[model samples]
Target: MRLRHIAYALLMATALAGCNDTIDGAIDVSKVKNKVEQPLPGRIVAEMQKKNMPRNSPIMIRVFKEEGKMEIWKAKADNRFDKIADYDICAWSGKLGPKVKEGDRQAPEGFYNLTPAHLNPNSKYYLAINTGFPNRYDAVNGRSGSNLMIHGACSSSGCYSMTDAQILEIYAFARDAFRGGQSSVQLQAFPFRMTAENMARHRNSENFEFWKMLKAGYDNFEVTKRPPEVNVCEKKYVFNQQAQGSGQFSAAAACPPMSTPPALTAALASYEKEYQVAYAKAMDKLDGKLWYEPTEAERKAIVAEKRKGRDLAYAPTGTSLAAGKLVEPEEFEKLMAARLAKQTAKPGQILTASTQASAAKQGRVVLPGTAPGNRSTMSVQTAMAAPAPGAAAPTASQTARPQPDMAQATTTGSVPVPAPNPLAYAAVQQPTETEGKKPFWKFW
Candidate 1:
């Protein structure tokens, strides 16, 4: 009976062991179902420069807000950029302005870098690009809050957004950066390319002079091999700040003297003043920047005004206004067509008279009475020349060509003649049929 008990106990223990195994198997299947996959690291390793990327080289990324573009470059031998890839980007939660703080929904402008600690695989946005770069200046001056990431698609609360495919490629690039010996990556985001033409167009307001300084710093770095120094403590942007010298060397040349006239400067200022406000408002909308969410009525009014103005300025109207004042659309088109026809007409050709005689009244020389045998209807100089003393003026070509009607000639010092239609002349004067009927044709 004791032996029977022992055998029965052993059988029970074996069954319990099997039950444990079954439970473990079920858990394994559950884990597989919930698993998140990451692409193999360094799939695009061949594109990187082997020498410059030690076991861990630092990478650099630049995002241009206005262009909606991003560029990735690896440090290369001779201390230059070897472009790895470029990606289209969607940025920020808010419009074109620099992000001031958390939940402002604005994307921060200026430079930041990536750090290993910030990488998150389980990010709500899928994959996240580590931004370890701290703007030492920003941190020191307390400009912006931290943890900026360039991550996967899911509209940015403040990060740069890329589609899943793009993030995969980026992940591989980052993997290569780590394998090559990059400690961290640098990211610089800017509102736009700080070009002189662009700045002059948008930076008209007194408030925007600050932007000019920032643009200068960006431009200086573009030419020099260094990141600009932040003199933010001094409340100014510093130019040509040095990075750690990699034994590269150069000296900047002296700048040339300015030759722009004061008048030209004033003219440009005037132009900017006239157009910048409307342009800025349009750009703000395009960038999704508005202080308060506009009501439909307000939005419609602004949009209509912009559309009307833009259409008037650019569309091919049949008529034009003498001044930049508003005119009825149809009338403007007619006026433009008339003006163009007037400009294209032969010097002596007469046009139908109209009350709007501003150009002629302003001492514009007018064509006068036609002279006999003259190819042009009138000699333009006759409008200015005094009548010759006691000289019987030669009759006009119209008088010569048509039957002399003394009454008409005496009243206006000119006579009207029926002019041949040019198109009719072209049709009648085409190469005669006889010209095509050569003797060779007859032989054939």
Candidate 2:
């Protein structure tokens, strides 16, 4: 009887244990299902509706090194950009902050521009997005020849990289930008928030002031909740002026102070001597009013020679001409021809097959990114279906969509709805300032 009672008790205890486990498992599964079934955040969904998010438009890429995040804003047909996607990136190498000088191998800070010329469709990264603008600020301060790229795969010596999955989304925007005639894309890469706390972290470094200015812009944008307008010229960036205007016309814009007249004269003299020889030869091929005073005999000769090429030998007269005199014409022509031969010329008017052949011998310039090394060839995937003309894009209302991974979407912070096809908005926000910063050069 004792043995029977013991066996019975053991069996009851085992059954209870199994029952508890079943109940716990059911509860856990229910909790997970509940979380998954919850509706998408109102902010994100609202933004999607407001921006008509994901319509084809120009793309604005912003990389925040501090946040390890890359944000993509798509331009609408109207030419305004709405926040479309955010990507996680892996720097892989380099230091933990903004790049300032050459040999740093650190990711650059400030703004860059990209065009189709910069695109690398066959890149090892599978997809590459050209930052439409390079840091004009760096080049203006004399840092040129650094290549900045966003590519697929988390492998980089010092570039912004993404996983293969993330790159697909990025490539979609880049392709649209290229086809949409916004062939060039704009990029802004920043170190951190340029926030006070972040700046204080580097309090002992000499780059504090540099950070201060960048921080000001960053803070201004963060607080105002607007991207600070960036205008770039010849690889230089400035905030106060439009990117493509004559800075002299603006009174309020902060421009590089004009150099003294002597400096201007010297520069003009150098340019005139270097360019005038070649220009004179080309212009000599045309009929034009001469800047130099011509004798009646020379003028008559010039008129007669207009149909044929001229070998007119003019001499210096005043001190200005004498002091700035060019070498004799025959000698100068020889030198200029040699220089021209050395240069990779633009498409010149050959006008004849023989001339074309001769010019061709000067050799074609291997445009960067077009070479096999740069991955120029494109991989075109055929679309499975075609849409009718002027058809509306498929939206949530039009189709059943799969839910995104909740874990992946959780990282994105508060996001505002953006206007759909904001292309016009970006086009209208014309840069208010334009000026190239002087390069850092010292006369040897």
Candidate 3:
């Protein structure tokens, strides 16, 4: 009887395993049906054919907020991902930062993933893929938020929005990957491009430490062109193993002994070595000083030089009454009176007629007007020969005055205009925390 019972137990165990396999097969079949029905499957297949990649290959996504770009990377037969496309993010809320809480209306920045359940074909925004926010790392740190997504409709509250056409293609990529047997797709979102220059520029930001931690993961894929195995330990993200043992990982507990593949280890080491060399050179070029900061004297000199260039470019150049040389007070008053009289001269009267008449009355040599063209020439000669109302004799230098600089009249300080914030859109309705009633079909 005991032997019979053991046989029954073994048979039951085998049956259960078969049932599990059957269930998984059904799920995959359903996914394949959904994917095939959409136009995306054909396009994906064509892309794979063009690249000499097999169908249902793995894929990944990377988002750069400051650049407003999302890149799709597809795994080739060699197991390394190749960039397939870049889509413009149509709209995203908030500035360059991570989403921390509900109602903050901030798009998240960090590593996240999507599963089959996260796909929403019936979404109001046309389609969406939920970003698994508040993952193990977020939970350990007590962060909270939900339903963050990359969706369509070109509008956003706290989501990355792409046009309907773009989302159609993006959604198809993820769907085909899932249908191809991928369990989950990884998505890495960043505030900006992770580079040595960007790191140095934002070194003093409050989020610098967190960003540095993220760069480890960024560099992993950057070097290997493969998605990094992600794990959270002690409330921090740890990527690509550093020690050897079972591959088990825990979110809140101390990380277990882990080891990286020898080839990956060597590659990462070489990448870091090159990065350090470049970083050092960049720092040395800056003399270890912040690029944005300048001494007061240096700033003033810069402004002065800019002002001088502007004046030279824009200042008007011409002969004018104000260009006359400095003279005795009585002589200056007489010149001003002559200019005023010439300006107010009656119609049909020559511009210098009043000045010439006054000069002739003072017993000055007044030349006769020749032809119309020569009239101006005669007037100029007559004025040059005339003396001030009550001044002494003239000197040779007094007759030839240097043109005055019109720098003050032309120089204008440029007012720096602040750029408009891209996130300043009409406020979107905040998502409610209450879970809606589940479909009756789910009860089964």
Candidate 4:
């Protein structure tokens, strides 16, 4: 029995040795030998100096897929981080969502950290850093994918691809940080800038709940300008806290008594207070209308209204005035008279206050800065017939529907037209249709 135990111990020792060798062998130092020897770029060094940041300070990377931008942030002496540089991603695959399975061609989105073990110096793509997919949160969700990378080559297949030149500079940044004793570098991947406006715009998206959770970490960083310490518990990301007793965490286990530094708690509270004020202001600016699909009834009403306007604008001759044909002959005579009067009027003859007020009461869409003679076809025929020197201005009901100003139209003799008061058109409101049915779609 003693001999058998000795043999078992020897086997376990051999297996451990083999595992270590395999891990070490996976790294190809030859591929990065030249880069490791080369000095950091002069521009980057100069930027660090200007920011008063020391060389070899810790770094964080942020990738915004929608903007196709990658930003590098480095720690300063004050314990805060500042953006050092931004690079455009040469290429990427898939759409704006997290990768779920292998062969899906989707890029993963979440907070991931990388160590030297994640680097691939011998990549076919000039240089590559494996994004450690199937992270704690992903694993708890049963997601599966592998070998996802941020690499050089200007080509992507489930990766963020950068130009060779850009990668060399990026690779150098990482190497120096690692050499300076940074055990790991955090990488925050986001779909876009997480602003209140953007969040409101995507409020009805399917992934809104997930995005809200991501925003917590995003907000933390935004307030402190430092990476939030992230951990996974109950399959959800918890920021800047740790289990009280064990001082350890498990992605699938219930979270232990967690606490945040008092200073961070205070800062986050202040940030949330300010954010709430701004968020309310932003929401108030919106008209509370979903910009997505309209109801069937609303669609039909819009179509009918457009058709009715078209018929009124081009009615046939002899139609009753009540049936939407503004006495055609009288309108024609008015247009001709306006044209003749305009040709003879003095350049300095501005419209009188009462005339302008009458036009406003008429709901005529006036192009404020346009020359008096420059008017739309309908305006010339009805609202702008250059009233004879002392003639009365027309009332609101007397004019036909307002038409677009000719001065602002895209034509040969176009000129700048002043913007109208936004509130002026607010008087016209479309009636809402009540379908009396529960919505079939669920945003959550």
**Model 4: ten consecutive residues of lowest lDDT:** 403-412
Instruction: Predict model 4's lDDT versus the native.
Output: 0.57
* Least accurate 10 contiguous residues by lDDT in model 2: 403-412
Q: Provide the overall lDDT of each model, using Cα atoms, as 2-decimal numbers.
A: 0.41, 0.41, 0.56, 0.57
Query: What lDDT score goes with residue 50 in model 1?
Result: 47
The list of candidate 2 runs beyond 4 A from truth reads: 1-50, 75-82, 100-103, 132-134, 181-183, 223-228, 232-237, 240-444
Model 3 agreement with the true structure over 1-444: per-residue lDDT tens digits: 999999998987685444322322221222233432354434345667788665668889999876578998988887678887787776666545678778876788877766666687778877888877766667677676777789876666678887666777788788777767665678899877777655544442335557767777888788878777677765577776533444345566666666556676677667767766655555445332221211112223433433454423221111111122323334433553454455356767664555554543332112233124322322442332332111134344123211111000110123121232222222322222244532211221
Compare candidates 1 and 2 on TM-score and give the better one: 1
Q: Which portions of model 3 miss their true places by more than 4 Å?
A: 1-36, 41-47, 246-248, 284-444
lDDT of 4 by residue, 1-444 (tens): 999999998987685444322223222233434743444555567789999888888899998875578899998877679999888776566555678788876778888876656676668887888776767677777787778898876666678777666676777777777767675678899866777655544343345456667777787789778777677766677776634664455566766677666676677667766655555555445434221212212223433433454423221111011122122333433433353345344687665544443443232222222345434334433332222111234345232211100000010112121233222223332222233421111100
TM-score for each model = 0.42, 0.42, 0.55, 0.57
Over the stretch 373-444, how does candidate 1's per-residue lDDT look in tens digits?
Answer: 221211322211211111135224111111000000000112121233221223222242347622111221
Best by TM-score: 4
Candidate 1 regions exceeding 4 Å error are: 1-57, 130-134, 139-147, 205-207, 225-232, 235-444
Q: Candidates ranked by TM-score, best first? A: 4, 3, 1, 2
Task: Rate residue 263 of model 3 by lDDT.
Answer: 72
Candidate whose lDDT is highest: 4
RMSD in Å for all candidates? 32.1, 28.7, 30.1, 27.9
lDDT comparison, 2 vs 3, better candidate: 3
